[model samples]
Target: MHWSDRYVGQDYVADEADCAVLACSVAREVLGLDIQLPGERRPGPFGRGALIQQHQADFARRVDEPADAQPVLLIARGRAQHIGVMCRLVGEWWVLHADEGAGSVLRQRLREMARQGYQVEGYYQWL
Candidate 1:
């Protein structure tokens, strides 16, 4: 079974089942990759700014083409705020992410997210 199955229908919870939390969990469980993002230890949101930027610089490598199990970032408003895992489904690329509005894990097309004001910034493989 794919590692992501465990998170497919999980209800979204800030600082728990939210994007960063789930994405980070997916990374470690599915890809054996470990990452520490903002707000994990203290009271704040995940991937605030400096922490994720530095984490990306130190441990992640950006890729032109996304692949299965890669972490994909979705830009909200002007800054990138949401994250999801790239999953191959129905022969196309889909993002499995946690959505607060949906109140659960959401699987959406790569293009659909862009239309929803969440642009696909890029995908990353954590090392």
Candidate 2:
């Protein structure tokens, strides 16, 4: 199955299918790696420290340049809270993620999100 098949139409549940979970799930599927997220099922921030720690241990290395199908983490309020897979649709860079505001999985143009003040904290490749 393709990575996008995991939860393409799934609605975003606070702890269930949030941005991080969606990203991690796709990464797991595409890269065939094991990623264990915290058991807490809350909608708020997943704590920057914990996220950084997990990424350090699991992801291969920090990527300065993101390519299509790469996993990326987004920062909000100085905390890493959102994540998605980088993709190109219609010759523009987009991110496929479980958007809480949208209440479902959707693809948004990366540049548009940045213009709207979304901070891309880091990008990493699955190990």
Candidate 3:
């Protein structure tokens, strides 16, 4: 199952489940890992303490070079809210994520999203 499908159309309002949580939850379920709120007691990329950035680095490092790894999602919010997948230099694009509020886990172009500076702070992958 694609991560995009898991939470498309799901309401995140009042949940504070940002794009990072959405992608992480989908990855956990797919990887058969127990779902729990990711720990926030870690240092962030910037000195301001951003847990999401740390999670992304951790997740990315875990699967940095798996031969059979699938593409991961990159989600962003605010003025340029969107979702996209990471792909091999020449391989099928994985359905990494989608704008759930858009009610569709549609495949998106990664380059465009990256150009907009959406922080790809984490990833979902099968265990």
Candidate 4:
């Protein structure tokens, strides 16, 4: 089945599941790859959890297309640790992600994950 079908009614948080889910959906749609599981649960390449590393790699290797074609970089964060998609670029200070709180995707501030103290592990993607 398609990823969209699997995502129906799937709830998420701003910096947690919502970001991860959005990143997964975008990766699948744009990259045609899958990154759901890993050898073992470990921190992401650039972060402290599996999901962040997975999403970052997927975006860099695949989704970092042309400016006009570049898809959003979905991410997972926070205590609840959810995921969301990066929908668009807003100027130079912010990137957009799907916000479950609003029941729709929206753009928000863009901060370096390192500065924010977030980590990554493995991730799933489409490309």
Candidate 5:
């Protein structure tokens, strides 16, 4: 079974299933890759930022336009605070994330998120 399939409808927990955890969960479950993230094991946005920066070579930064199903990291208020898997369903690009606000894993339109002021710091392809 696909790892993503396991997370559909799953709820989000701040320190347990937050953005970073969700992203890493996908990596471990789907790709069989284990990434060690820093910051007391429950790192926040800044910690995630450091993790991305440290492993920059393992990712190809997205610079052009956004695409579907790409792993992305988002920034809010100039801090890297969110991460998710990009997905396209029903002809719309959505972010599959463990939303803190919604308190669950949900899919939100990429455009709408951007309109709400969340900046796509960058998207990355695992290498």
Candidate 6:
């Protein structure tokens, strides 16, 4: 069974069950690495990016290619505010993430989400 199956369709709650939380949970469970994030977004425009950078420094290793269980950071409307766990299915990378608009956890093609206006910033594996 996919590790992300349990997270699929989970209701998204700000500062609770959102993308950051879900991504961290997935990493810890699947990679056995604990990456921490704040429940509430920090103030200012770079809040999310700052948090991600901190986590990366703490335990994440930036990788050039996506794998079965890597975390991907996404940018929407030019803001670094979303993160997800990626799984390779049929040779395609799919992201497992939750959002308010989707209202739940969903798996979507990386390209699909990119077409939806999310720019994939980077992929990382927790160390």
Model 1 C-alpha lDDT per residue in residues 5-33, reported as the tens digit of each score: 77888999877778878887888887887
Better of 2 and 4 by lDDT: 2
For each candidate in turn, the TM-score is 0.81, 0.74, 0.45, 0.35, 0.70, 0.84
* Candidate 6 colliding pairs: none
The candidate that wins on lDDT is 6
Query: What are the candidates' C-alpha RMSDs?
Result: 2.7, 3.2, 6.3, 8.3, 3.5, 2.2
Error of 5 at 126 (Å): 1.8
Give stretches of model 2 more than 4 Å off. Answer: 1-9, 40-43, 46-50, 53-57
CA lDDT, every prediction? 0.75, 0.70, 0.43, 0.41, 0.69, 0.78
Stretches of candidate 3 above 4 Å error? 1-3, 35-49, 53-91, 98-107, 119-127
In candidate 1, stretches whose alpha carbon ends up further than 4 angstroms from where it belongs are 1-3, 38-51
Assess candidate 1 and give its TM-score to the true structure.
0.81
For model 6, the stretches where C-alpha displacement exceeds 4 angstroms are: 38-40, 43-46
- The digit string of per-residue lDDT tens for model 5 on 1-127 reads 4335567678888777777678777766666767555545435667656766666565446546555545787886577667788776676777778877678887777888876557787777654
lDDT of 3 by residue, 1-127 (tens): 5435545555543225544455456546644554454555332223213444434444444355322223353434432222234443345443445444554444444445565455554444533
Ranking by lDDT: 6, 1, 2, 5, 3, 4
Question: How much is the lDDT of residue 97 in candidate 3?
Answer: 50
| Candidate 2 pairs with clashing backbones | none
**Which candidate number has the best TM-score?**
6
Show where candidate 4 strays beyond 4 Å. 1-17, 37-80, 85-93, 109-127
Model 1, total clashes: 0
Error of 1 at 114 (Å): 1.9
Instruction: Report how far residue 78 has shifted in candidate 1, in Å.
Output: 1.7
Clashes of 2: 0
Range of the 10 consecutive residues with the lowest summed lDDT in candidate 2: 40-49
